[model samples]
Target: MRYDVVVIGSGFGGSVAALRLAEKGYSVLVLEAGRRFADHELPRTSWRVRRFLWAPALGCYGIQRITLLRPAGRRGAGGSRAGGTGRGKTRAGQSGGRAGVLVLSGAGVGGGSLVYANTLYEPPADFYADPQWAGITDWRAELAPYYARAKQMLGVVDYPRTTAADKVMRAVADRMGAGDTFRSTPVAVYLGRPGERVADPHFGGAGPDRAGCTHCGSCLTGCRVGAKNSLPKNYLWFAERAGARIRPLTTVVGLRPGPGGAGYLVDVRRTGAWAGGRQTIAADQVVLAAGALGTQRLLHTARATGALPAISARIGALTRTNSEAILGASVPRRAARRRRLDFTDGVAITSSFHPEPGTHVEPVRYGPGSNLMGLLQSALVPGGPCRVRRWLAALAGRPRDTVRLLSVRDWSRRTVVALVMQSVDNSLTTYHRRGRLVAGHGHGRSNPSWIPAGHRVVRLLADEIGGIPGGAVTEPFDVPMTAHILGGAVIGATRADGVVDAYHRVFGCPGLHVLDGAAVPANLGVNPSLTIVALAERAVAHWPVKGAPDRRPPAS
Candidate 1:
């Protein structure tokens, strides 16, 4: 059977598309390459190591190797697969590729909303300043309503400052004279009296019944308590109720545009820890919402093999990592072991700091069970012969010092995980090599303005909290890791400069569209998921449904 639309990847973008398209009375088939998890099936405690972190045994997390190549698309430093078992199967159960795509995206039914920190913010004005974007769409105006719609649907709320971590961080900021910089961040968490269920509090009761946050601190562990709002709780949930079929662990490998005016043929596969199988899907329109890494790999492979040769030569050009850096500092030794310090119990990201003009800093928390502290401490321990001798001497003189020092201490009181994001724009491209994605060349000059600005904020955090500043020690040659990767297959004025048109449609491929972070024209200096959702809503509004006239007239 054919579908009106086959959406690839079920993350934020695809989830919204599936819901809206299905609500319009179309047969929408969502193909997700990851497995599905029920609310009850999610891990309850961080100590449940297998389930807490994305692992093959838990049927979550994809272990794909990711390498960063130079801008010239030539050789650069290669990296190893970071963590987790390189096991499990796709929906088709196929395996055996280097795990270079180490993104923390949601693979199952809910998508990244399930795994991501629930920080949601509006895109800044600079986002619409691109000349290329002005020709195709008026993003600022077109997306305003959709942004409000998405916020309500996601149950976005202000974080409560109840936890010890929140209190201490605020005190530190106040003491350091940067009190104005620290404020409660907007989050997509349920915030009402405990166990009180309300139906669509944001909407006019058209959405789901959401129980308020219990402050379980399990937001990162998948919100088993139903307090953390994710797409599965609203959009996807509503879509299913409206008759959309969400096929998890079902990976779409290839696409063949149909003959004449027919739609497209989508090649499918299965994945998990099990064996593999294959199938085909016929659809009149295809929405590629497979996240940046997944979609780039698929489209690059298709172009290499001439499957869709009309794809622009600029397919993988203009990529961006959103100028993000995950800088963290451990809590002081005295505060380490307090059970009441439960970092995971409050909002995932409570307060933010803007010490400079373009940079934004926010507090992030990880449960003790996450072992993130151990990693940070290990990295902070000074190295070299003096360090080794000092460690040995300390071990002999103060036997338990090392372990005790590493213990969960009053540090959470003074410590805050500040996620530094900047408006200074920088991006990397993508290319296919031996059937995998390697970072494209042209690693632009590190945005000097943003770096100093971020450092100033970190210093302010240190001064306010009486804590040490910390982050990954990258050598002069090493690149930083970013969670917010965007661009590539960007929307451009013409097919010559981009893969898609301003309306996000593939120039030559009439019915295909890309509606995700990949299509963003510029860095919004903020978390992009909200903006992406709004853009998808706008794209769907422009979709030529049964009753609508085509917005763009056909070739003359």
Candidate 2:
């Protein structure tokens, strides 16, 4: 079938593009590589790893695809193979190249929203001061109204400060003399009376029915109660009602110029079926919204295979991870066994505060029965070559302490994780090797440890909370895992600087655009969902109406 616009990957960017283009009277087709999840279909708990995680080859097709690469090991890493089974660089998956790509992202129809903490924060004023983004359309001013529109569409609101974790975050902020920076996080969950089911409040009663937030703290596991405002609940939801077609479990495999150079041809393979089959379709325009990893991999493949040689050489540069760190502590022994703190009583991130300039920390939690994350933590140790050695020493020296954390009884209720993010600029370039996309850090920076500010705050929080502080397993290995991975196909003044223009159009491939995290040029030191959505809104706003004369400059 032919479409006026074919949007790939139904995440924040793709969903907004599909909805907007459809609104402009275009026949839109949105192809999602993951399955469409119904509210009841969401896993009740995250422990069902096989059902809650996403690894199609492993028969797991839910949200939350956790990719872990063992940093650059001895002899310098060349990248690792990816997939549920089979061993080859030709398979369809993101390769963890030389330096390794340790990231936490979402899958399925609604993309990250299906598994995100739902925090919708606007970046601080200084975000616009980055030299890399200077003179790029006065971003803050241009996006102000769009940010408001995105907030309204996503149902963003100030978090209700009613959880123990919330109080703890505020207290920590006050004790540090930064009380003014401590505030409730803006979240996308419904705030009507708890457990109340009401007609859609944001879409003039024309959208899906939503349930009020019950504060299950399971936003990362998928919102089974419909309180979480995932993309399917808003943009994608409305797009379908407005004549856009959404096909889930269909993965795009190839792209080539269309007949007569008026459009493009796209090939897709069916996911989760035996004896793979393929189909091709035509689209006048293509908008990539496959998140950072997915979009980077696809664009890299296209460029390397000569399918789209016109793409800029800067296809996968400036990949940012929000300078992120996952740091937190288990509840104190006295509080855990006596006071019985319920860490899972509120939204995923109830409150946050700035502990240092360009850095922000928020209290993150999981719902009851979701103790799987406990496995990702280890004893916190200071940075250096001996960090991993020290962690091992602590583990071997205190076996019982380790066992206590691994035991699942009330684990979710007894622990809180701090989601740390920073605006500090640093990046890696991704390139294809042996048919897999891998990142390469320039100039011998083999291992870049987490920012020291993150470590300091983590240590302080652990001390104040009366709990044993710990760091993510990757931290010891000089690799900090991140949830908000941005950049890669970023905006720039020319093709030499970036793959896309400020308008999100490909530098050489007209009618092809990147409107996702991949287009983001710098870290915002906050959850990037709201920023991505606002940027997408801007990308769509610049697009001429479908069937109208194309106003974009012709490829040079």
Candidate 3:
């Protein structure tokens, strides 16, 4: 089949591209590797790992995909896959004294929104003003209207409920003298009455039906109540209404210039099906929106195999992780007054406070009975011999008694997880090695400090919440993990500096573009979903009207 534009990934970028391009009278096709999930199909909790995680090989249909990458050299190796349920069992070469970096990301039709905490944040001006941002255009000013459009489409609103965690965050801010900065986080969730289905308030009923947030705090597990404003609920919904064709469970494997030498040829295969059934499709334009990891892997493989040798050498450099950390404290119900701390009373993140410079922390929660994540939580002890000290401090006096307190059921209800992120400019690069991708801190710098200012805020939250400090899966393994992975195929002043231009067009490959996190030049110090959407809007705004006389070139 041939399309006017083929978008390879139905994420924030691809969804926006599809809607806008179709609105311009072009036929658009979105190929997503993950199955299309209805609200009822989403798992209520993470306990059913198979249904709550995205490992097609293992038959896990969930939205989260966790991988451990062992660095091949001094640079630390790690990569994260956050879009759809397609699985690859490829492995890397074994090495010594290497710490494995934990990568956490989302999958499925809505992309990261299927598992994201729904935080719709705009980074401070400093991010755009950074020297690494090589742009002739004033991006901040240019993206303002687009950002507003994205927020409206995603149903951005302040979290609806004030929970126990909210009060604790407020207290933490007051005590730290940054009280003014403490406020409820704006999220992409419907805030109408709980359990009530409502007309599309944002789109005047033109969009899909939505349910009000139930305050279950299971936004990460997948918003089964349909309260979360994932891509499918907005952009993709409108795209379909506009006649765009969305093919879920279809994975793009390779791309080359079309036989006539003007468009492109894309090879695809059914995600869960066996081999030898690849199908090739033709397209006048191809927008690479498979996200940071997916796009990078595709381009890297294509370049290596001589599929697109014009791809820049800077393909896998400067992948940003928002300098983030997921650390929190778990309070025992017995220690709380009347055991009244219900951790699941609001959206995934309710309130946030800045504990120190370059640090931002938000109180995160999960719904009751969705306590499977408690397994990754361990007592937090900073510095040397963390593992041994953590166990010793957690037990304190009686090991047997403390063990019961660590039970998943009680731990989740009593815990307030802090989703800590930073604006500090630290990054790693991803490389294709031995048929697989590996991430590592680029040479000439020590490993990026994964737990810096964030740890201090974690400690403070533990004290205020009346809980023991806890660590995420990465901290125990002595590595780093981040949900907002940005960059890799970043934009730059010229082709020599980056793979894509400021308009998101591939430098040497006209009629081809990358419009996802892969093109992000730097970390936005916030959830990157909104930024990606706005950028896609900007990219599509420049798209020529279908069947128009040749005006601007397809790519600069």
Candidate 4:
């Protein structure tokens, strides 16, 4: 049987497409490569690695997925491979890449929503004014209504309460003379009484019932508290009610034109299986929402293998990770235990402030039961000219701090991990080399490797919060980290510039669309989930209903 539309991943973009298209009376099938979870089935903490991490090769089928990327496509820097386009050579002004850039993503029925902090931020003017696709439309104006729609659908609101973490963040902002910039984060969570289950407050009872947020600070581990508004609870839920079906563990490997223009034949298989579970299915139209990594990987390999040769050469030319850094400020374990300072008393990221121009910072946390991420931190060590001297000096200054961070089992509960993002653009060109993603720094600013402002902010934050300021273990070298990876199959006016058109339609592939983060053309400088949803809302608003051409949500 041929589906009217088959969405390749059930994240923000795919979920919105599934709902809107299904509401239009089209048969929609969402194929997700990860498993689904009932709220009860979701892990309560990161310590349950077998249930929280998604390393299927190791028999773990969970939501969190970590990908380590290196430059020049070199494999063995103890890195997990990032998918790339085809083999290629770089011209002058680019050479051996940075040490490592670790990307964190999610794998589940709801995609990255399963693991993201519930922060929802609208991109600033610079994002809407970006030169890449600025000429196409007045984006801020165009996306305004859709952003409102997205906020409503996702149950977005100003964080209802301030916790200890928020107070610290506010203090930090005030001390830095940026008090006006400090505000409780906009979040997607039910703000009902703790643990109180109520009928759907969104969609006029058409969506799922929700329980109030418990302030468990476990949003990143998966919201077992029924508070965080992951997509499965809203968009996918309504899509299913509208007769859309979802198939989990069904990964699409390739796509080829169907015989006589019937559409496309999508090669399918069980995701992460070492053996055979391959087959093919037919679809009249396809929407690729498998994310920046997954979608670009498929398109690149398809183009390389000649399965989808018309795919543009720019498929993997531009990938952005918000030019982010993961830094930490944690009181020592002994002091933390004495004060009983639980950083996990609020939502994952409750407060944010801009400490410097072009940079956004949000304090993040995890609950007591989850501390695995502590493995990534170490005392801050300045690096640049005096490498050996700096290391020894850092050890002398913060020697006990490193030991405390490493030895603390309740590190997650004691620390706030501040995510710092810069509008200063930097990028990676990801392509397939020797069956793996070969990534190299693309043309852009080089400061992503070392955001001096971000380091200063973290150090100051530590001082204010009564702790030692350190950073991700990879920060000393090439390990910049980001949870918001975006833009590979980006928008362009023609096939020569990008793989997808402004409407998200593939430039050369008819009836094909990329409606996920991968299709985003500009750096958003904030949590990108809301923008992705809003963009998808606009993308499907242009789709024809089953029997007519009249607009559904009315064209933007």
Candidate no. 3 TM-score:
0.90
Best of the two (2, 3) by lDDT: 2
- The best-first sequence of candidates by TM-score reads 4, 2, 3, 1
Candidate 3, 173-239: lDDT as tens digits: 8878889888888898888888999888778888888887788888988988988889889898889
Pick out the ten consecutive residues of candidate 2 with the lowest summed lDDT.
82-91
* CA error at residue 77 for candidate 1, angstroms: 12
Off by over 4 Å in 4: 73-99, 383-398, 549-556
On lDDT, who's better, 2 or 4? 4
Estimate, for each residue in 203-266, the C-alpha lDDT of model 1 and write its tens digit: 5777767787776555665776676778887788888887889998677789887767589989
TM-score of 1: 0.82
Worst lDDT run of 10 residues, candidate 1, spans: 88-97
**lDDT score, candidate 1, position 342:** 43
Kindly list the per-residue Cα lDDT of model 2 for residues 1-556, writing each as its tens digit.
Answer: 9998999999999999989989989999999988999998999888887658888888999898887533333433332211111211111211122355578999999899999999999998766666556665688998999999999999988986668887777777777778899888899988788889999888899999989888888988998898999999999998998889999999888888898777889999998766668999899888888888888877888888898998988776777777677877786455687976788998899888988677799989999989887778877766655666887898889887676655656778888798888765555666676566666662213223455655666677767667767778777666777888888898886787778888888888878989899998777889999999999998788777766876755544
Higher-ranked by lDDT: 1 or 3: 3
TM-scores of the models, in the given order?
Answer: 0.82, 0.92, 0.90, 0.92
Residue 270, model 1: Cα distance from true site in angstroms:
1.0
Number of the top-ranking candidate, with lDDT as the measure: 4
